[model samples]
Target: MSLTRRGFLVGLPLLLAACSTRTTTTSTVSMISAYGPIADDRFPLPGLNARLIQPHLRRQEVDYESSHAKGSLVVDTPNKYLYYILGNNRAIRYGVGVGREGLALRGNAYVGRKAEWPSWTPTPNMLRRDPEANGPYRNGVPGGPNNPLGARALYLYRNGNDTMFRIHGTNQPQSIGLAMSSGCIRMLNHDIIDLYERVSSGARVLVIQA
Candidate 1:
């Protein structure tokens, strides 16, 4: 989703001040090749067929199992994707929307909490940064039709505290594979719903620099 000037002005500072700690380790890359039409069940659009077909989502790079990382979820930002490293040269890849240049991050964290069609509450810090986002504060945006945190949310936590950054779904399918959120990583809503069903709370996550 393209960030409007309003969205940018509202999100920039929250993105910048967002910070976290990391434990770095190397791991093998899993290269995914082309395949037939694959249905991304997590993407929830009205009438259009929701599948990640070739060219749009292709296997470019794969990290084989690197000893340094045993149990970790890897996110390759430059590729606009996230991978839950399984083993050997295999990983479950999902397309994602990351933070724009000035708002990127690399690190390790665990899913603190998981929510389905999560309510969005712009933080006090977010409001202080942009008063225009005032009314959208406090209340969680309900699940279903129009919420931005589409189908699910895996809250990233550091040192047992919520970091405010999330790996969630987007109502904006166009935003997938683009740096266009309020710094939260966005996925096709259907894809995220599928992922939410697969991942348990406390799953390990690794965001890597490309």
Candidate 2:
């Protein structure tokens, strides 16, 4: 039942073709099932509309051969895929929305901290560039389903300094696979919660831009 990265890549087209025939109800059920259950105290996350996301962007396990040790987070930015290395040449991949145009960054960082339903504040530079979009958040926005930073956030740091970047959930699930954020890596609410549970503080994160 398991496939290697090469096998997965080779068979992906056929797999997607099979999935295309699944009933809407079946797809909905599968999507909901992927999320398991939510805790009562947590913010309610909406079900992802499968139509809004590309097939490759959906969360799945695949054979991933990586030089990084198991448990490291590797982000293939150009491909818009984030891989949580599981060793044995395997990983759990999730679709992501990354920085658009000039906001992208290339570097190595670590998860300095993490938060569930974390508050968000716009950086001074962000405010200066587009006050209308980043202005209201000057005082910080409380975490919620409607918040831009969706369900969870993994703050990225480098050499003990905050990089001010994040691997966070997005309110805009449709944005998955697009380069459309200020700089933070954005994931679906369901995807992020899964990642948040798996990632720990100080986990190595490699952002491969090429």
Question: What TM-scores do the predictions have?
Answer: 0.68, 0.83
The TM-score leader among the candidates is 2
Worst 10 residues of 2 by lDDT: 16-25
Q: Please, what is the whole-model Cα lDDT of each candidate in the order they appear?
A: 0.58, 0.75
lDDT of 2 by residue, 143-184 (tens): 998889998999999989999999999888888899989989
The runs of at least 3 residues in candidate 2 whose Cα sits more than 4 Å from the true structure, single-residue gaps closed, are 1-32, 35-41
| Tens-digit per-residue lDDT, 74-102, candidate 1 | 77787676665546644445668898776
Best by lDDT: 2
Question: Which pairs in model 2 have colliding backbones?
Answer: none
- Provide backbone clash counts, one per model: 19, 0
TM-score of 2: 0.83
